[model samples]
Target: MTSSLPLLLLALCSLSAAEAQLTVFNLRASDLPSGIVVTTDGYVKVFCGSASLGETSVRNNDPNPWWEEKFTYFQGQENDVLRLEVHDSDIFFNDLLGVCQRQINFMREHDCFLESGGLLHYSYTLNGNNQ
Candidate 1:
């Protein structure tokens, strides 16, 4: 077992180095419900598996908000699902606006919008393998 230990270690290291890139762009929403005449701070949380790639800044008081924020993350497996959750930020607790999910393989160069209670438009694209 010891004789093959070095080769096994090398293979594992190379596997970890194999990576892909995920880009999220042009997130905007309109026709949102104005609640109680209060400012709605809308933001998004993006996740691939358990790893969070962070979120966009809150757009205060704008029901029709455009967040052209771009984010990059270490891509998961091709079949893994990417989850996006939109929320309204509040002082005490935040309200969930919507939830969306898409497979990583289908995200590339495709428009992914989640509109149930509100309107949201965004796109995801994948870059070549990064090693």
Candidate 2:
């Protein structure tokens, strides 16, 4: 086993790590409930595993919120899964409205349906990781 140690080191050193970027496009939602408020102040908190990509701005007083905001993360893997959480913003604490998750893909759009009865219209692009 000791004789092959040098060869193993050479092989390991030759491997190149892949780097990619993930871009989350605009998001739109419908039927979001008001959480202890007169209207629903909705926003999105994005995550890939423990890393937070970014979030959109809060859209106030609307059951249907359309945020034409985009967020980007530079260290995305093709096998990585994303957690898209919809929340109702408030003064003290933010209320979770819905959640949906999906594996990274090379598709053009992702029409996600939140588990708590709503529609999420968003898309993403993964670039520079060989698709």
- Top candidate on TM-score is 2
Local accuracy of candidate 1 as per-residue lDDT tens digits, 47-127: 877788789899998888888678777655565677878888888998888877877775454334445366777777766
The lDDT of each candidate is 0.74, 0.80
Instruction: In model 2, state the lDDT of residue 16.
Output: 37
Q: Per-residue lDDT for 31-59 in model 2, tens only? A: 87654638888899889867997788999
Q: What is the Å distance of residue 48 in model 2 from its true position?
A: 1.7
**Candidate 1 vs. true structure, TM-score:** 0.75
As for candidate 1, its clashing pairs are none
The local distance difference test score of model 2 is 0.80
